[model samples]
Target: MSSSDHPNISGSSQPLLHQKGKEIQEFGTVNQVPLGLSYDARLYACQRLNRVLADTRMLYSLYKKHHWLMRGATFYQLHLLLDKHADEQLALVDVLAERVQALGGVAVGDPRHVAELTSIPRPPDGVEEVPAMLSRLLSAHEAILIDARDAAARVAALGDDGTNDLLVSQVVRTGETQVWFLAEHLVDTPLVRL
Candidate 1:
């Protein structure tokens, strides 16, 4: 058919794949985008966020263990630091889980799911040294921060702004803050503490 003879597509000629955000309703009223993200995008964010939560939980336990059991000349400071990190990681886990649920996917619960899904490498059992424990946690947190930023950017590109914003805010605020705290132990250049 000739271009002019072909029927003009109505409504959003923007194509479903590229279209996003709220639009006008049939009655000419604005409506929210109704959590109706593409399946692949939703699943991708779900798995990514779920993995992060699992890894953070593991790191939380590690920090708590170190906080209570660590011994050194700087024991008081290190103990407080570890405890503080545990709380931060715990809050991050909650945030991630909520995002997963918001995407309409079942979060992988249970320890088995975490063991399977977590991308962060596990520290060896019975690591009793302070420096050793801190090193492992710092490494894990770094990886998580990287992944969170990447995943958030990807989701935003796919037009899932809610998940994207959730991850972006966490990545910028939480991960950066944790990095400052962890860096102090290793930097040794009179850096100001968090």
Candidate 2:
């Protein structure tokens, strides 16, 4: 006649905790959380790693699309530029994915997930014009590199040794290189300034 009479709540139907325990036993225990840091630190590292991985994917796709569609103004140079940019981005994808796995989180592979999670903006529609495409591409890559640096700093500050090491030794260096390459294109160079 009372709520206590309910089997589910009163343990008559086996407590929810017990049921969950049984289910976990049947499914096998989940991965153990890594030690050596506060929960806040670990959570911060995971989120930072996720941010970098998603941004890597978004930037890679933009480079590839722009490579194929780019036209006008220094056509050969821009063509080669986009292609090389795509290659650089492709290399970063592997590093970011590995970092995500090392941190105990799944790397985002689905384009939908990348789009949903990435802070970077999508390339504007029908942006086949070369200078315009180059401008957008530069901005996108710069934004991505900045996020990578920020995430690296966050992970380092949280004392995630592995992520910090990876970030310092490779990720940040490559990102800076790519950013430099993209930025250099925008500088005005005189044909005859001698």
Candidate 3:
């Protein structure tokens, strides 16, 4: 067929029209799932996951701040370590957010939203000493670990196996490891004399 014979197919190559759809789901609500869990279970899981997500996001921010503000004899080491932990926490943030969404809940995206959701205490705006910074990081990690452990147990009891697995395998494990590393930095052991 000649180009003119296919007028419908060659209609100036314009893009297809689109329209914005109305919001179908609210932030605090969940859609039905066939995972065999009760509505109460999914709702509870999402609430717990959202809390973890908030704290994880805050922890990631602390890591970045400490990474930039690092200063001491171990500056290079701590700087690199904090950046690495930040990246790890960032990964956990994504996992937690996705888990919340999979449970049909909206993940908090804004920093202000996270601040409102998170229970982690806000740190000073300016730079803190190296020990103080490391201590702060450890404290954040512990807070997350404690919550994840409790949530995992409760979610598992509620028959939300997926959330339980995520809390135990990813969130708790990562937080515990990071806590160990940060806590070691605060040890008073002498490098050479002791």
- Best candidate, lDDT: 3
Candidate with more favorable, higher TM-score: 2 or 3 = 3
Best by TM-score: 3
- The regions of model 3 sitting more than 4 angstroms off are 1-22
Better of 1 and 3 by TM-score: 3
Model 1 TM: 0.74
**Who is ahead in lDDT, 1 or 2?**
1
Question: How does candidate 3 score on lDDT?
Answer: 0.89
lDDT of prediction 2: 0.70
Task: Provide the lowest-lDDT 10-residue window in model 1.
Answer: 24-33
> Candidate order by lDDT, highest to lowest?
3, 1, 2
Model 3, residue 13: distance off in Å is 7.8
Candidate 3 on 138-193: residue-level lDDT in tens? 88888888999999999999999999999999998888888888888878898697
Clash list (residue pairs), candidate 3: none
**Residue 104 of model 1: what lDDT?**
66
RMSD of each: 16.6, 10.6, 3.8
